[model samples]
Every structure is written in structure tokens, then in C-alpha cells.
Target: MLCIYNLQLTQTHHFFHSKKGVPFADYQGICNWLTRLVQIENGKQLTCNRNFIAPLCELCCASSLQIGSLMHAFDSVKSALRVLEESVALNCEEETTKSCIQYLEAVPWDDSEEEEIVKVASRLGPIAMPIVARISPVDLTATRNVFLSALRFATSSPGGEGSGLPFGDELRTSAQEQIEYMLGEDEETPLVTADDEVRSVARAGLAQIFSSFQTIISCSLSETTETEALHIVSDLVWMCNVLPKMDMMKDFVVRWTEASIVEIIEDNRFESIVWGLKVKVIEVTVKVLEAVGYGTVILQPTLRVQLLRTWLPYIRKLKPILDAKAEQDPSFGHRMDEDLCQNIEGAIVSLILALPSNDQGEILAGWMSGEQVKFPDLSEAFEVWCYRTKSAKRRLVEGGLDRVGNGNGRIETTEMRDMTMIPSAMVLIADTDRKESLAVKGSRK
Candidate 1:
């Protein structure tokens, strides 16, 4: 009831400020009332009650209040911070801790002040790890700390204790949002530098996520409810999204295409717990492959092949099913928009063009034989692959050669007396008169 009243006061302040012409400072009486929620008397501290704990948290809340510097009494309030520190020390209720954390996160450190905020954040130790991520953008130490913390929740067991806890979900949700926002989610371009140091963070995070996924995957889906299973699927999708941003797409392909995950994917019984998960996995795979194939996410030749061979079958079978289902459906819950469909198709075609002819032939043959034939309609990749492979010799002869620089032919062979005869070959010819004379003499001889 006290927590509810505390929230109502903030709402009441907003109501007067927005509706009436009064400023937030007009609520000075209310602010002073809430500020005293945490106090000490007779050489003893108050605010032991859970209800007052949240109200004390609310007193220090409102980033705008701190930013506006209204209500001078609430401006430099340290009691809330004291309560928060004590709460963390006591390992208090999740709601109180979360509210305190939220209040700290809301503080306008960069805009208003930082001395006290940084001190509290540092004193809070690892519990304030996520706050450091938001408050300090260029602090790699804080970024790495948050990344490690994010990785911990990212790799947590699906049905573990944290899975059911309110604060645990907050942490997990914070983990997801922090990583994305830090990496530049809605921005025009990625904010991540992906430098050597950042890559190291990604590498370590990748290793832990792999180990956690591998461990949790061995547990039967029947052991978890649909919600829990979906949570794990969401984490895996989160992994998929983060990998491409960090230039770890190829690394992910190597791990996910391994037999352990394949066994789960191949077991496509409709009623089985794996079905929903399998579909979502393929959805993320399509996006991953799209990134890799479109060159947005660069990868080596080998991992591209692994991605195609492992997920192509599923992509082929599921594209139509995805098209048939609405996002409102429980079974196929994801929204596969038209742009996504085109992207996957184009990406598949791009990858197909990169493969050897024999492999393309095998993939195309399987596509033609199954119900998947008309779904992905890889005829774009198929037709292009055939023409590229069959006309390889002709195109090579016709397209001629690229002359990057006029340099001496390293081979020193006089076989090419007429450079025009080998338009197909990119023989680097140094424009040196001596080499040309030597080639002519050698050919004549």
C-alpha cells in the first residue's frame, strides 16, 4: 500500500505539471514528505519496512527532477542512496532492489552530476555493473563488465532458478537491452567499434554462450514448459543477432551446424517440443545467413557452406509454412515479413552463387525432389548457378583480364609472346622494355 502511494505521488506531480501551469517544484511538500521515508532517530536507522523501501526509492527517482534541479531538498538527497546501498547489503526484496537500481539508472549523471553517482555505483560493486554500461560509454572496463554479466544471463539455464524470478527476468531483459542499445540497435549505423579489445569481449562472451547452450541443450524439452523453452529460443536468437554484429557469424555457423543442434532440428514432429523451437531457429538462421551472404556480415568460405548445408533443408521446408501462418498464431509466432522473405531468398541465391557447381547441383537436386521445390523457389540460385558454371570457360575468355598494375610478369615464361592470345588470363606484365625484348627474343629463338 505504501509503495502504491509513493507511485501515486509521482503520478500526481505529473498530473499537476502537465494539466496545470504549476512546476514540479510545486510538489515540494510531497517531495519532502517522501524524502523523510528513510530516516534515522535515536541513533538507529528507519525504513526497515518493505513498503517504505520502495517509497524511499521513489523519492530519489525521476531523472527529470534531478535534471531540472527543482525541489532543492530532493536535489541533493543522499538518504535514498543510503537505503539502496543497505538494501543491496541486505539482499533485500527484488522489487525494492530493482526500483533502487532503476532510480540510479534514471539519474542524469552526464547532464547534472557524477561525483556521487559514480561513488554509489562503485560502492555497489558488481551489482551496479549494468549501470556502469549506461553511465560510461567509452569505459571499456565497464563495457566488458556488463558484457560478462550479460553473457552470464545470456547463457543461463532455461529452467534455472533465475528463470522464474521477477528480478531474474529484469536482469535478463536488461542484459538483452543493454547489449543491443550499447551496440546501436535503432541507430542509423552500428555504434560498436569492433576493435581488438571489443572483439576479445565478443570472443569470451561467445565461448561462454556456446558452453551454456550446449549444456542446456542436453536437457529434454519436456523438462520445460513452452514459456521456458521459448525463453531459451529467444536467447539463442539473441546470440544469433549479436554474433553478426561482432563479426562472429562464421563462428556461430560452426557451432550451431554441429550434430548436437542438428539432431534437435531434424526431429520435426509437429507435436514435439522441438517443432516450435526448430521453426524459430530457422527464422534466426535465415537472418544470419542473409547477413553473411549479403556481405553485411563477412565470413569465410567454409562456414558459409556449413550454414547452407545445415539450415537450407529447414529453410526450404519452412518458408512455405511461415508464409501460411499469421503472426497471431501460437505455433508459428514469428512475423516473417515480405522483406525478410525476399532477403532470405536473395541471400540463399547469393550463397548458392559462391558454392562449387557439384554442391549446388546436389542442393538443387534435393530442392527439386521435395515439397520444398516451390517454396523458396531457389530457381534464381539454380539458374544462375547453372549459367555461371556452364559458361565459366566462355565468360573467362570473354570478360578478359583485370590489370591492377603494370608490373613484370613473374613467371618469366616466353610462352605468352602474344598477350592478346590469352585475354582470358590475367598475366601481370611489367611495362619494362627489357622484359618485353627478352620475351620477344626468347620466343623467336
Candidate 2:
């Protein structure tokens, strides 16, 4: 009926344009021709023929600037923009697309002119977002290339400043919504790997998106913007391989803390981001312990007593991993069993020998009376114990130290002549705070 006749009329319009030397009287006539031609079902095929689209391209390109300017006279910039959008859409090849973008970019902008484009782009953002999602996976490499180029041009071009228009915001949000939709796909989906050109494009796109997130977090205006920025940061942090490069992320962790970010990393959500982040808690703890010795921090005797009585049970769970190499090699395991205790005893012997002989009684009395006993030398003493234990393990494996069989599952070593060595290591570490207290008291006196 009417629909079939209208379709035939559209095809006839395409046939008219496809022929060479077919000329329209003017730009209005050219637009009218294109309007009829666009209604053709095989318009893409006709346009692909090059000759068919020559008149339309001539209209879109040759008079693009004048038509854009004329667009305001009829209050028809909307139609101009639509035609430009359509002209680019029909010629889906790279060179044509580039020419189309160049023409649009070259369009003259005044306060009123740019405002209209920003309004249209903003209204189009949500519609473009869903379209990108639906079609991304089928041809990710091609889609990503186009998207990356568009975003680059959107974010980098300079214009529309002080024009009472929010073109920058509209362009940024619209382009970002499209990029985010592609990246938000399920993990199981296979990513497109077309060729070197395509991957290079994808990498550049991901880097730009990641940089945008970083810029947002570091430079955002307010709390709400920062929160949105954090969401973006969280996404990149989880998706990328970031763990090995710890220092690069320190500022991000500090920002998270300052921003009062308290969310625990869930098992699945942002798993990559979480796994990639350097362990902030462990890094902070080690730094604090180094600057302020063990006893002055969490290991102060009052806390140490509680921690040993309570937390040691938890810490023991980690011992197997720490002790893995010692047990794996039986020769080494046997040597550790034979010499560890005596090696520890030798360190204590050297330390006790160096102490003022008469002060030994005072030290003993302090310990016996339950007074605050000081271990000024505990740090060096602890280092020696660790070294000796590791060395003994190595020596047993090397057949340098003898081992005695013990039925218990625990690796039993030969008994030291001085059994006090084991308990003294703990005592020295626990008593380090008392030495600082004594120094403070002496200074006051």
C-alpha cells in the first residue's frame, strides 16, 4: 500500500543520486534528496558504491561549514547536526570517518552555536550507552578502536570555554558512558584480538580510561565527585595487574584512608583490583615496627603477655609456610634439629659474658622480684637468634650438625647446656620498653 510505494520512491531517489552528473539546484535541494535517499533500505549498499554517495558527500563536505552556519537561520541546526551524524554513519570506513570528524571539528563555534551541540550530545548519551553494550562483544576490536579515537578527540580538543555551555562535561560523560559499557562485560567473554593495530588501539584506550580515573580521584571537585572517582579507581585497581608495582599505588591507598574508605574487599567484587593492590596493613605494620621498636609498639609486655596468651594461637597458623624450606630437605631439617638450641645458647653465653659480672645479680633480682627488667640490647639479640636458627637448619641438611631421632612430630634438637636461652629470647624482646622507661626516668632525675 502506501509503505510499498514510499519504499519505491526512496529507491528511485537513491538511483538518481547513484548516477554521475546528477546535480541538485542548491543545498536545500541536496538535503531533500538525501532525506529521500536515506529512506532507502539498500542505502548503505548504494552509498558504498562511492558514486551514489558523491552528491551527498559533496553536500555534506563541500558546504559543511556554510550549511552549519545557515543551520541557525532556519532554527534548523538540529537537522544539520543530524545530517552530519548520518553522513558519517553511512560511510563506515576509517578515512571517511576521519574526514567527517575533521569537518565537524572545523565547524565554527560561538556561545549559542556550541550550546546546541552540547545539549544534543547530552540527550544522546544514555541512548548511545545501551547501543554500545549490545554490539560490543561481536566486534570488540573494531568497536574499541572507534571508541578510543572518539574519546581522545572529545577529551583533548580545546573550545567552548566561557560560552555558557557545558560541552566539556557533556562530551566527557557521554563518551565515558560508552567506554564503561564495553569494559563492564562478563569476564568469561572472549576479548577480540584482531591484530596488532587493534590491540594497540585497545591498550591506548584502556590507558586513557585508567588515566581519567586517576585524574578524577586526584583532582575532583567535591566529596560526591571523589566518591564517583573512587568507584572508577576501584574498577581499574581490581581489573589490572597492579600488585607488583607497589610504590605507584601508595598515594591511592593514602587517599583511600584519608577519604575514610572502610569497605572490606569482598571475595568476588573487584577481585582483580583487590588482589593487585599491595597489602597496606602489612606494609604499614612493618614500617611502624622498624621506626619504633617492637616493645614500644604492640609488643609492649602488657600487650605481649595478652598477645602471646591469645594471638600466638592465631600466628601459629602461619608458621608452616615460614618453616617450609626447613622441613622439605631432610638433611637440612636434621641439622637444624641438632644445633638450633645450642646455637641460641651460644648467643646468650656471649651476651651474658659481656655484661658487668656484678650486675648479673641485679638483673636476676629484677626478674625474680617481678620489677620492670630492661633489655637494652634486645634488637641485636633477636637478629642473632634468627640468623643462628636459619644457619643451623642449613648445617643439618649439609651433614655438619648431628641429629637425634625424636618420636614426637615436632622437630626436636639437641638440648642446650643453657636451657635459659629459649625463655631469654622472649624476655629480652618483652623487656625492651623497660630500658626506654629507665632512660626517661634517668633524664628527669
Candidate 3:
């Protein structure tokens, strides 16, 4: 039976790779053939032998398959996964799940194999996670490792040179576009077309994979040390930063805010965390706030207040280090310190801008009046807020709202004039960075 199966598999491989070049007809044919083989292997007559399963597993593990073949290959693997899931349910066969995991684990993790790995994980993860969860701890850990590895593979940079690809930003934008399109409601077309249905399914599947990835990250954080947890927290924040765009995953934001963000902000060990880690956390937090603003997701007022309270101290702590570094080396390297300060201020500005207008005033007042406020970034932020408020007030005046009462029987001019007219600190920061880059390049030349 094993020899016959191998021969058939080889023949199928040849059929798909023929010079005719994978006709559309071959997709269903391959799927049916693989489905039938799985049925026979899982049938009562075959005694559910492990040897019979090895050939089928090998077929799934054939990562060398071309793109034309991968579609059918993944379909077949999905079928095999179903068969294993059924066997585990009916016969209590833990070995079947283990074997499936082992085959998935064997998939290569280099550039050549990335797309296949992504396809497999995106398909198999949702199916495999449930079964893996029910099995032993060893199996769970093994499966988690494989899933995390595949996730890192999928999201990481293609050539593996830098931090992971900006998948979070891409996925967030895609989700936002989809949501906007769906919400437009401009048409009431009768029947949903096949393409629309397929896209809907795809979105749902992607959401599931995202949730699984979050769970894996959260679980990893629970088991790791503080340093490891910091790394995981960075990933968590990165993921959370993008998640707000997907309305379906709003719960993730709540989970992150309550579980991780609060702890990181409130923890007394803030002084002990290294500078790089601190930067990562702050950057990701800023990203999360920006995502919130773009999506217009309304965070709880208390949470907003807590974010400001916690971030202020960190920004204060960061300033001395940055100032000290500038004093020590006021050269090209000082550009980095300036950049960090700019980023920290950018985050503060974003956070403040995300607040309601009334709340923004309160937050700005506290920051500008605080005795501990030593960073120039705070003043920069204050200037940006003043400029924005001035813009808003000007718009109101142009719109003829100047005559409107403040609901307190007084004009609003007194409040608007008190705000200063400084240039946008963000644009100034950008121009400075550009000039610095050009100067550095010229010096090097």
C-alpha cells in the first residue's frame, strides 16, 4: 500500500509539473486524489498504521513544490489535517496529531520557502491549534514553537536584514480599506458575488490567524523572563498597534491595554529597563496611539489619563540621558539623540492630539505646568498643540462661529489668543533630520 501510494504521489507530482503547465483542471484532480488517499489511510481496513501515514506526511512536507503546485498542495495538507483531527477524536490517537505537527515542523525557514511556510501556517494554524491544545504539554509547546517560528517567518523581513517587515502597518491599512468599503453601503446589489464571498472568507481566515498569533505571543510572554518578556511585549505592542483597524479584533486592544500596557507603565522597574528596550516600548506605544487616532477608536478616558501620567515620567527620565549624551558628543552621533528626542515628542504630540479637545487642554496644562518638565520636547509639544488649536479657532471664525456664545455668555477669543503661534515642531524636526542626513553624507564623501 505504501509503495503504491508513493508511486501515485510521484505520478501526481509529474502530472502537475508537465509542460502543459498546470491546467486549471489539475487543481481539483489533485485535491480529489489526495482526499481519497487520506480516506483510505484513515479507514478501518488499514488498521491506522503509522507507516501508511508517513508517505502522506512526506507529500505535505514537499516545500519544493512550485507556486502552481502549492495551491493544491496546501489543499491536500488541509485534508490530511482534517483526517488527523478526526482520527484523534475517534480513536484517541495522539500520535496522529504529533505526526502532523512533525511534518509541519520540517518545513524549511529560508527565503525560498517563506511563501509556502506562510501559506501552510495560515491554513494549518487554525486547524492544528485546537487539537494541539487538547494534547499533552509537550505537544502544545512543540506546536506553539512551530507556529511562532512560522509567524516570525511570515512577518519578518524577506532578506532577514532588519527588524521584521512592517506587516502590522500593511495589514492594518488593508483592514481599514476593507471596512470602509463595506461600510459605504452605496449599493444594495441582490446576491453576493463569488469574488466577494471569497474575499469575505479570506478576511475571516486572516483574522483567525492573527488571533492565534496574538495568543502565541501572550503565552510566550507568560513563560519567559523579564528580558524575554520585554521582547515579547515589543511584539505584542507592535501587533496591538495595527489591530485597531480590524474592528473584529478590538478585543485585542482591550486585552493589551489591560494586560500588558498597564503593567509596563505602572511597573516600578522603569528605571532598571535598558534604553533600547525603553525606546522600543515608547515607539510601539506611540504607534498604538497613532493607530487609535487613524481608526478613531475611542479609548477609555481613564486609560488615556494613565497613559499620559506614565509616559511623562519616562520622558523625563529619558531627557537627562539624551542631554548628557549631547554634552559628551555633540557630533554626528548627537543626531541620534536628537532623533530619539524628536520621536519621544512626536509620540507625546500624537497622544495629546488623540485626546478630546477639552481633555487635550487639561493634559497640556498639566504637562506645561509640571515642576518636573525639563525636556524641550514638552515645550515643542505645547507649541504644536497651540498651533493646532489656533488653526481650529481660525476655522471656526471663518465659518462664522465667532458670534456664537461659549454657552457661558462670553466670547471665545480670550481663550484662543492665549495660545502661541509657533511653527509646527514636527515639520521643523523633519527638516532638521533631512539637513543632518545631507551634511553627514557630504562629510563622509
The candidate scoring highest on lDDT is 1
lDDT of 2 by residue, 168-281 (tens): 556544554554454444542224233455345544544554565545434423556545554444444432322112112332322322331222232234333332121322
What would the per-residue lDDT of candidate 1 be over residues 20-136, giving only the tens digit for each residue? Answer: 323444344545555464355456665545454444344334323432332332443354465567557645445555555655566555543456767878888887766556655
Find the 10 residues in a row with the least total lDDT in model 3: 185-194
TM-score of each: 0.52, 0.20, 0.37
Better candidate by lDDT, 1 or 3: 1
Alpha carbon lDDT of each predicted model: 0.57, 0.38, 0.47
**Candidates sorted by TM-score, best first:** 1, 3, 2
Candidate 3: residue 253 Cα off by (Å): 4.4
| Residue-by-residue lDDT tens digits, candidate 3, 360-385 | 67877877676657563555445545
Off by over 4 Å in 2: 1-146, 150-165, 186-189, 193-195, 202-445
Using lDDT, rank the candidates from best to worst.
1, 3, 2
Please give the RMSD of candidate 1 to the true structure. 17.7
